[model samples]
Target: MKILVLLGALALAGCASKPVPPDWQADAKGALDGFTDDYLKGNTAAAEAEFRQARLATTATGRADHVAQVELVRCAAQAASLVFEDCPGYATLAADATATQRAYADYLAGRWQGLDPELLPEQHRPVLAGGPIGAVADPLARLVAAGAAFKAGRITPEGIAQAVETASNQGWRRPLLTWLGIQAQRADAAGDAAAATQIRRRIALAAGQR
Candidate 1:
């Protein structure tokens, strides 16, 4: 996943519990709503604008924590948008972020950085552990970790396959579709006939559903 210019919902960075000013909350919430609405509607250009609006919200009446949180949201949007092949890492954002908020950045960094387990701190393990998929608290997050694991050379294709299956079972269609499309292309390039066929079929089914 490229720098998540997040094209989807789920405010990963807001997981932090910074004391937001009451006055600033309205603008922040508005920007978030606009960005998410535009993104889901496939208006990426507009989505980018809305996210920028979010950034602007931090410029006025925001603390350092608020600024970091806004950047985190922007980064996630960039990553999910797939506008670029490489998304920017949270770097200090992860380091300085609230414990709750940092995991999202850490995991995203882990994916972009190629399965570096160090990116995911020890405290984050519970969420990253489990069966076919990682923890089931959020199937999307689990799938992300599984993909990162494959890239880092920690898991075989079988491991990812199981996670993918579980994601589908959980009805995570959009993210699953997006993932399948990428995997299909990779399998095709690698001449993995079995994987390519399976991924393609899944993609086709997913497309039809949409």
Candidate 2:
């Protein structure tokens, strides 16, 4: 699906790899957490090394899925500079993100909208991973609260809209674009053609397409 192509960049970034065997997952989250802590303290060098070690530990399992997850952290460390914004270790991260967003938007143009957030699987949520380099954003509690609201059937688009705005404000570029594309699809599905068109256009602009 177009959504998968758009998200592949981030998914492959390493947080949500395949559900590995229990033994592998036991250390996966901790590896990420340790890296998170180290990066938050501005000890990126140490974090990188720590992450590399964690990734290596996955080798014993020979679980491609778990290894991919660990490698995501390793990738972050590779791209990470002493500065936080630097990551994915490859110079093409931004261009790749831009291209992916463009492809998603183009795919959505003229498609039926009416999308429901509830229909999106957990793995498909448009949230970015990684803590800030010298700062932390353990918004996990908040995320859980939001998710609970959905489970309680008390969630509102307004709340998601606010979160989307916040993500944009925080400069989480790829997630912001992905969220916008989803909103556009929902608007189309809601029969708000005008809004949908506008959203598609915005998505295009964000993707540097039109």
Top TM-score hit: 1
Compared with the true structure, the alpha-carbon lDDT of candidate 1 equals: 0.53
Estimate the TM-score for candidate 1. 0.55
Which runs in model 2 stand beyond 4 Å of their true positions? Answer: 1-154
Give the alpha-carbon lDDT of every model.
Answer: 0.53, 0.42
- Residue pairs with colliding backbones in model 2 are 79-89, 113-189, 114-189
- Model 1: per-residue Cα lDDT over 1-210, one tens digit each: 211222222233444487553545556657766775465345678877977777677558535556566666554434332222233434544455555445555554444333343445343354345344444344334555565444434544565565557547756454456557667877988999998997788778866743
List, residue by residue over 32-80, the lDDT tens digit for candidate 2.
Answer: 6576446533466876776666666666765544454454343332221
Q: Work out the TM-score per prediction.
A: 0.55, 0.35
After superposition, the stretches of candidate 1 with alpha carbons farther than 4 Å from their true spots are 1-21, 33-42, 77-104, 111-124, 127-132, 143-159, 162-174, 185-195, 204-210
Cα RMSD, each candidate? 7.0, 15.2
lDDT of 2: 0.42
